[model samples]
Target: MAVPLLSVAAPAPHLIGDKAYDADSLRYWLAERQIKAVIPSTASRRTPYPLNRRIYRRRNVIERLFCRLKNWRRIATRYDRHASNYLARVALAATVAEWIK
Candidate 1:
């Protein structure tokens, strides 16, 4: 999704995935399409992978986002069986959460 989304845009995104996406294929794929990858290397990688230490430290924002989103009981339980309905609830929840913030 990231690849396709970035590919069709006027400017590409600088990818900032975690060490999980540090494989050769992922790096090569991003580089092949002119995307700047910021995935840090694992201890086992053959060489160090470059990363922006400042940006990487804020990775927990994703976790925090989910933690906030989960405060919506409907989303947490996934009571809406349909995908469309679920997405609507997610949007509604986001709007409400924004106001709360």
Candidate 2:
């Protein structure tokens, strides 16, 4: 999923992800694209890769934003069946959340 999406997306300097994205292949893929992978290594790995804890910490904010967005019942339950409507509702919810913040 990440591979196809990234292939078409604009290049970025860094790719931030959790432990689930710590596969060697993905790391190599990102390195090939010159994008730094800020993913934390999984515990079972024999040699964990070095990570920039400071950069990885930023992912928490995005996670929290999604958590807040899910507070809207419509988005959490996926009430909008259409992709366009769902996107619009998400935008609206994000706007509202920001306004209330």
Clashes of each: 0, 0
Question: Candidate 2: which stretches are off by over 4 Å?
Answer: none
- Model 2 per-residue lDDT tens digits across residues 6-62: 899999999999988888889899999999999989999999899999998999888
Q: Candidate 2: which pairs clash?
A: none
Residue range 1-101, candidate 1, lDDT tens digits: 55566567675467767777777877787888777787799899677977888777667766667788999888999999899999999988887776787
Q: In model 1, what is the error at residue 45, expressed in angstroms?
A: 1.4
lDDT of 2 at 72: 94
Compute each candidate's TM-score over C-alphas.
0.72, 0.91
Give Cα-based local distance difference scores for all models.
Answer: 0.79, 0.91
lDDT of 2 at 9: 95
